[model samples]
Target chain A: DVKVTQSSRYLVKRTGEKVFLECVQDMDHENMFWYRQDPGLGLRLIYFSYDVKMKEKGDIPEGYSVSREKKERFSLILESASTNQTSMYLCASSDRGPQETQYFGPGTRLLVL
Target chain B: QQQVKQSPQSLIVQKGGISIINCAYENTAFDYFPWYQQFPGKGPALLIAIRPDVSEKKEGRFTISFNKSAKQFSLHIMDSQPGDSATYFCAASYYGQNFVFGPGTRLSVLP
Candidate 1:
């Protein structure tokens, strides 16, 4: 079975603070993605990395950045957290194939106050 | 722009009844379609998937019906149970592009 683990299941941060969400996958997939899940809006991609040091902006990339220094780890960074940034963040990894299934981590519920 | 559109934002089905969710995509390049189920406080999990070449694929009580010409696909849950209640998302992607997910459907299976 494929395992995708997130650094935190829940997090609390103050406004204007920096926040980091980490994810690790054991499947050695080549594609890693960061998304924020919101009610009614569904899952919107924030950023994705196809390979180490290669990143692409998804539909909702503002106020967020990503790091992929290694194949197994991907990190999401928030420069200045705000109340509006509070959301459930999800990380996923997929193999390098057209139809490969993307396995997702449990997710981190972030609360900014 | 929402590339994929899903209908019935919420659904309630009784046990032993059928639960159906529909999704439509605008991109013809999209060849792979997958459905994901997300429980409360949990991440979305891949439930079943279908390709354009096949009209339907079934796994247990979960079935995916595909219509290539209409650019649409749907998920049918037979004998709905309380455990089947979750948020279902339909995603579309091409060979090399990232997936575009639909708005999602919240299903509640009444026991």
Candidate 2:
């Protein structure tokens, strides 16, 4: 079975602190994504990587950055954590195809104090 | 702006009843539509999906009804049970730039 594992399930950070959320996939999918889920906002993409060392900005990419140095790992970074960044972050991976389904990891709920 | 919009932030249905959730999209280039089911403390899973070429697709009790002309699609859960209670999201993608998801509907199946 394909599995996407997140490094942390819950995290708490102070304002202005830098944070890292890691995601690793075992299926060797070429495409990986980062999204933040709010109460009524659904899942909005923050960033996505099509290949190793390649990244693209999603709809909401401000205050965030991504790293895809390896094929199996993708990481989301919060430059300066704020209260507004407190949300459930989900990571996903998929094959490099237009009509492929993405497999998501158990999300990380981050709270910024 | 939200490319896809979903209605009824929450829904309540009794066991053996039908549960329906609707979604509308703004992009015409989007050709692939998928519905995801998410449980508490878990990732969203693909429940059912449909393509623009088809009007409807059914996988057992879960069905996706698509209206190509109206740019609307819906998920119908027949004979809903308690185990079916969860959040559902509708998503669309065009040439796979990225898959955009709906706000999601929280469904509660009563005993």
Candidate 3:
């Protein structure tokens, strides 16, 4: 079984503070992704990394960035957290293949106050 | 614009009844479709998936019905149970690319 783990299950930060969400996968998957899920909005991609040091912007990449220094770890960084940035952050990893099944972490519920 | 459209934002079904959720995609390049189930406070988990080549795929009580020409697909839950209640999201992707998820449907199975 693929295991994806996040650094935090819940976090609260003040406005204009820097925040970091970390994700690690044990499956040695080549593809990792960050997504923010909101009510009625579903899961919107924030950023994705195909390989080490390789990053791609998804549909909603504003106010956020990513780092993939290693294959097992992917981190999401908020330059300066704002109240609007509060959301449930999910990290997923998938193997490189024709039919990839993304395994997601439990998610970090961030609250930017 | 939403690439994938899902209908019935919410659904309530009684136990032993069937629960159906539908999704349609506009992208012709999409060949893989998957359904995810998300419980409260938990991340979405892959439930079942189907490809365009197959019209239907069943895993236990969960079934995926696909319509290639119409660019549509659906998930059918037989013998709905209270444990089946969750948010179901339909997604589309080209091969193994980044998946575009639907708006999602909140299902409630009344016991």
Candidate 4:
């Protein structure tokens, strides 16, 4: 079984603060993704990394960035957290191809006050 | 480009009843359709998936019905139980690409 771990399950930050959400996968999957889930909006992709040091912007990447310094770890960074950034953030990792099934972490519920 | 529209923002079903959620896609290029189930404060997990080549696929109590011509697909949960209550999402993706998820339908299985 794939084990995806998030650094924090719950977090609260003040406005304009820099926030980091970390994700680690034990399966050494080559593809990792960051998504923010909000009520009524479902899951929207924020960023994705295909390989180490490789990153791509998803549909809603504004105010969000990603880092993939290693294969097992992917981190999402909020340059300046705002109240609107409060939401559940999910991290998922999949093997080589995009068609492969993704294993998701429990998710981090971030509250930007 | 890639958009998936889902209906029934919320649904309620009695135990042992049938639960259905539908979704339609505008991008004909998408070949993979998948359904995900999410519990509160948790990430969505893949429940079942189907390819355009197949019209239907079943796993346990979960089934996926696909219609290529209509560009639509649906998820059916048979013998629904209270434990089945969750948010379900339908998604479509082309081969080896990012999936576009629907708005999602929250289902409540009352016992």
Candidate 5:
């Protein structure tokens, strides 16, 4: 089974504070992704990492960044939390291929004040 | 811009009923289409997928129907039980790259 784990189930932060969300996958997939889910907007990809030290911006990458220093772990960083950035963050992993299947983590609900 | 559109923001079905959800994509370049199921308080999971080469694909109770000419696809759940109730999202991609996701459809199955 493919297991993806996020560091937090819930988080609360005030404006201007920096926040970090971590994710780990045991399957050793080559591709990792970060997405945020909002009502009516669905899920929007924030960033993607196909290999360590490499990253690509997704549709909604503004105000967010990602780091992949290891194969199994990916981290999403918020430079400064804002109310508009509050949403459920998700992490997903997939094997390296054109027919890859994404396995998602439970998600972290973040609240910004 | 690539986009996927889905209809019927919410649905209510009785037990042992069939649930159908529709999606349409704008980019004809999209080759892979997948449906994802998300439960409350949980992340989305891959339910079923279909490539443009096949008109239909089935796995047990879940099925995907594709129409290349119309740029559309759909998911049908047979004998939907309460456990099948969740938010479903349809996504399209080109060889699994540059995925574009639809809003979502929330399904409720009553006992």
Candidate 6:
């Protein structure tokens, strides 16, 4: 089974604070992605990593960055957390093949105060 | 602009009835289409998927009907049950690329 685990299920941070959301996958998939889910907005991609030290910006990459120093771990960093950044963060990983069946983590509900 | 457009933001169906959600894509380049079901407090999971080559694909009571010429596809849930109530999202992606998800439809099956 492909297991994707998030570092935190819930988090609260003050404005202008630095926040990090971690995700790890056991399947050693080559692709890892970070997405923010909002009501009526669906899942918008923030960043994605195809391989170690390889990152790509998705549609909504502003105010967010990603790190993939290790094969199993992918981290999302917020330079300065703001109230608008509060959202449910989802981590997903998939193989770099034609069958891109992304397995997702439980998600981290962050509240930026 | 939304690349994928899903209709009926919310739906209500009685048990044993049919629940249908529709999605249309603006980018004809997309080839892989997948539907994801998400329960409250849980991450979305892949439910069913269909390629443009097939007109229809079915698994159990869930079915995906696709129309390549129109660039539209739909999900049909037969014998809707309370447990089937969840948010359904339709997504389209280029082969091996990032998927663009629809706004999603919240379905409620009345028991």
Top DockQ hit: 3
By summed lDDT, the worst window of 10 consecutive residues in model 4 chain A runs over A94-103
Off by over 4 Å in 1: none
Which CAPRI category fits model 1?
medium
* Interface RMSD values for all candidates: 1.8, 1.7, 1.4, 2.2, 1.8, 1.6
lDDT of 5 by residue, A5-107 (tens): 9999999999999999999999988889999998888888999998899999998999998899999999999999999999999999887756556788999
Taking all chains together, each candidate's TM-score versus the true structure is 0.96, 0.92, 0.96, 0.94, 0.93, 0.94
Model 4 clashes, total count: 0
Q: Score the docking of each candidate (DockQ).
A: 0.61, 0.57, 0.63, 0.55, 0.57, 0.57
Root-mean-square deviation of each candidate, in angstroms? Answer: 1.3, 1.8, 1.3, 1.5, 1.6, 1.6
lDDT (0 to 1) per candidate: 0.91, 0.91, 0.92, 0.90, 0.91, 0.91
For candidate 1, lDDT tens digit of each residue in A1-113? 98999999999999999999999999888999999998867898999999999999998999999999999999999999989999999999888766766778999999999
Clashing pairs in 6: none
lDDT tens readout by residue for model 2, A1-113: 77999999999999999999999999989999999988767788899999999999998999999999999999999999999999999999988665677889999999999
TM-score of model 5 vs. true structure: 0.93
The per-candidate count of clashes, in order, stands at 0, 0, 0, 0, 0, 0
Error of 4 at A58 (Å): 1.4
DockQ of 5: 0.57
- Encode model 3's per-residue lDDT on A1-113: one tens digit a residue: 88999999999999999999999999999999999998867898999998999999998999999999999999999999999999999999988766666889999999999
Could you tell me the C-alpha RMSD of candidate 1 in Å? 1.3
Span of ten consecutive residues with least summed lDDT in model 5 chain B: B92-101
**Candidate 6 lDDT tens digits, B1-111:** 348999889999999999999999988777688999999978998899988889999999999999999999999999999999999999887655567888999999999
Stretches off by above 4 angstroms in model 6 are: none
Candidate 4, B19-111: lDDT as tens digits: 999999998877678888999978888898898889999999999999999888999999999999999998886654567889999999999
